[model samples]
Target: MRSNRFAVMRGTALATGLLIALAGCGGDSDDKGGDSGGQTLKGVTIEVAAVWTGAEGAGFKKVLDAFSKKTGATTRLTPTGDNTATFLQTKIQGGAPPDVAMLPQQGVIAEFAKKGWIKELGPEVQAAAKQNFSKVWQDFGTADGKMYGLYFKAGNKSLVWYRTKAFQDAGVQPPADWAGFVKTVQTLSDAGSTPLAIAGGDGWTLTDWFENVYASQAGVEKYRQLSKHEIKWTDPSVKQALKTLAEIWSKPNYMAGGAAGANSLLMDKAVTDVFGSEPKAAMLSGADVVSANISETKSKVGTDALTFPFPKTGAKPPLVGAGDAAVMLKDNKGSQEFMKFLATPEAAAAWAKAGGYISPNKALDLSNYPDDVQRASAKAVIDAGDDFLFDMSDLYPAAFGGTKGAGEWKRLQDFLKNPSSVDATAAGLESDATKALKS
Candidate 1:
């Protein structure tokens, strides 16, 4: 299946401007009237805002069209701009918010909940979601004891995507633990191939590696606690996690270029560097990049790609995936109806068919997916229950997690350049995080 290794950990948030536009356009329609047709609701148009455009956006539009036909309610879709978080914030502050917004980041959801800008899904929506989705959706959407959102689809992050033929040629098996994973990297390097392809320019992608290391070393729950400030930055496990990442990057031919030069590579280019040109690279540790890059290159799907669960050091748990939450802005009839529709099995099935990633809902059968990799990914997301950890960036404060936090990326780069300065790097991160929390 196409690995969700990166997508699952990268919680996406809608841009603020797009969200505001949706809210402004749909607010007046919420109060119009009930069903004008026989048993079908009408005169109510729900403004739906999403961060997707192009093919994915078209898929969402298809779902909206289906919903409109089913309820006789007109649906207006506004494509959120590339800057998803900013657009949503502007929309919320402007008092023009979409009735239903799909927020990719949990941090944004939590902030909106705190400000009372978004409405909680009441009894009707809650009942439908519980009936339709797994407990993971409910758990992720709940904040401060209220259900504010629902998980529409999920992505698994702790996976390593590889070229199947390369592994066979090298006579190396996928690693199951930290030691073996390192050995595999060395084996690939010894065979004259880049051991790993990393996209450091997209800072968020690099954050995934940090999260994986933290999760592997400190455990998922502890990592969550650390993000929330329940645990200190100075915690031994956190330090060790950072140290482990540094050590791994230090290995000969571990990364495409040594860690210093790897920072220049972009996510898509990184994938091509490993899979397209260097056929013997063996693997790329990323989320769905294999499939995404291949598709982008117009290469046939599910041909040379394979994925293995990310290896850990101790007490390994099931792989964790990240997903976006479908949030409600106002608890009017229209909003409630829309949310209920999202909870239905039909919505999940439609999402699976769209082919970005698998929906988190276990009820959606993915037998129709043309690609075996995506189908397997769907199964993995369904099977990974409470063990799943949404994107680590989402778990942390927005200041540090968002694009504005270039300092975090700089710290990693600086450390890579001079390993002896690890102490300064840790201290700076802790200080910055403290400032972020306070602000």
Candidate 2:
């Protein structure tokens, strides 16, 4: 969803070395998870809610259809758009919450579980989750020592997608560190190419930018502490990260059509700018799903649109990530059965075959993904094991991080437009974070 994007607020072990050590960790699995134990739902209809729509919504529907075929139950997907947390709350208040809901933000999962609005999964679902997901993922879904959610979709938010020809034309390779990255940007701009395509219109994209930089500059421990709000947003680490971001953002010519132009471009448009017929910029940074957005353009994925990890900003770069977890909101025969099905590799593979998806399930075959680029990306997450950091904004309360024209989204957009306002931005973010997290 544009509003919240990817987040991992759980204080866990996340480091750059994890990604390096796990590069060759992907392998095929024989456990396809096809056994259903003779469970059947002939006349049941299950309702699922999530913020996925468009191609993402369609891909998930295919997965649901697979579930229906395996068990003979009808499945319906309710697209909640960008404001899923608020929408689910309203549904609950009206006594009309869906049978199962895919919570994208962990903060919402905690809030809902604390309010007793969500129910615990049955033993069958729990066992399957333990088998399919890593301990870090399982830990993320657990609150107060009880597992209430199962993460199905996973994201690697550290990639920077760019056009192959653009890099060749600019005579620059993807840089490995922040200093090299800034030099590369300047080279591209000096060669008369817009150096970056930032999706400023979608504020969550800016949050992604900040998260990657913050996690890289601040060590994983500090990143986790700040994510849990143990430290204020005005901490010196936050200022350092903002200044690091300003290296590129503060320069108007380093971006396509300048800051004003970037402020009007959405996620897809930002991708198109670099991969379109007449490319406008050299690179766009975000999650692996940016590959799907490129498919809508003139680029040919692995051949034309290539990706490199976000440049390192510290002693080691952090692997920032995001995902959606399936939680039971209204327990019943259908909901229980569906929740159990979601924990299987079959469920992940079903949507993965439709492309534009990555599964966190360790048992899922890497071949299930549609392309080499995506396969590599998914392997990075699977290999990282427990050493993963989620998107920081996604870990915050929705009022502070998820809302549009308010909270982190608006404040980040303001900072992106005027990178010189670091002091004011940090103060504003701290104020907003305090109110939202406390409320």
Candidate 3:
């Protein structure tokens, strides 16, 4: 399975720019009459659900607005909080699932498909996916040999966003390796600035931190094994990653609010600490979507704020990628049409132009991105191709990956608060993961 995914990535990377020219250009078809097989659905209303709120939500609304104009369909975005899976389950059980949902994890797609809740996409959507997306993306949406979803939004999590002024003040360039990263942190602190802004209040952010470090230090094969539970969390590789993380996380002086405040600081505020007036920190590590959080601040993206790939722990830095897949919960013309639209470059372009968005659609023109920062982030994913790994937590079941105050989320949060017990953290992770994956 891993080899097949990698093969597709390599092919996709090789064909990036060339595919756009060959993908015949008519994504907007406006024939208003019924039975004309046109995109005109004047009275149809499509309800979509996703975990995106704030800037991300507002950006997606632009895409829906574009779709509405092209198809005449009324669209509503029902913002599901961080626990989207739980919210979705409640709606499904109530016999009122949204027409479509943008699920954050591939495991959720498999879970829903196994429960017979998600519908297999029709041929049109499937074909559009084939034409625009790489086989790796298609595989992410497939279950038991059938495609059930389409990945529309992609994020590169191996980025560290830093203030340009902080770098200048500290006389430091972005670090190229783990050792240099550590020195950079200390240097920034000595220069009278907090070195990092950690969104410890949100467990998933910590998970991303662990993933980048683990993937780079342990190598991709071991990373894949651990992700599948083929290797226990107590393995030596896991221990090493935890200790590596502790190098910075264990130091309170390196973070805004000295760890305690960060434990309660949500992502937006953490970002603001770095970019807002009277900046408190020099850097924030997160997915490419962190740009959306940065957008909410007075920071000008390309000039005042910029990103460097996560520093290398091994021979090369790991590019940890993630995405949201659109799945159909109710089979109808309107839902199918919307899903098909999402598969097109035009749809991806709509959101890309709105800023703070990335698409894994190989056929998408990179020129659609608003700035060099956005384009560089998108290119890093495309260029990494077969070498990329999706967010590790998202690859696991919700019990282990998505819940709050329980499972991996809680266990990692505990690890953050007390970096003293690597063994206990590993044992706890393995214990919960074993039980969750088994059932």
Highest TM-score against the true fold, candidate: 2
Model 3 worst lDDT run, 10 consecutive residues: 1-10
Order of candidates by lDDT, top first? 2, 3, 1
TM-score, predicted candidate 3 vs. hidden true structure: 0.91
List TM-scores for all candidates, in order.
Answer: 0.83, 0.92, 0.91
> What is the Cα-based lDDT of residue 408 in candidate 3?
82
lDDT of each: 0.66, 0.81, 0.81
Residue 283 in candidate 2 has what lDDT?
A: 92
Q: Candidate 1 residues 118-200, lDDT tens each?
A: 88887977998787677867878988989998877577777778776667766798888888888887787777767787666
Higher-ranked by lDDT: 1 or 2: 2
The sequence of per-residue lDDT tens digits that candidate 3 reaches over residues 231-281 is: 999999999999999998899888899878767766767778899987889
Off by over 4 Å in 3: 1-39
Candidate 2 per-residue lDDT, tens place, 1-439, comes to 4344632111112223322222222111222223464336766778887766545655676777677767767666765657889898899999899999888887777888899999988899999988888998998888878889999888999998888888898899989988999999889888888889988888888888898999888989999999999999999999999999998898888888789988877776677688888788889887887766677677888999999999989988769888898999998999898888889888899988877788889999999988999999999999999988877887888888788789998998999889999999999999999999889
Order of quality (TM-score): 2, 3, 1
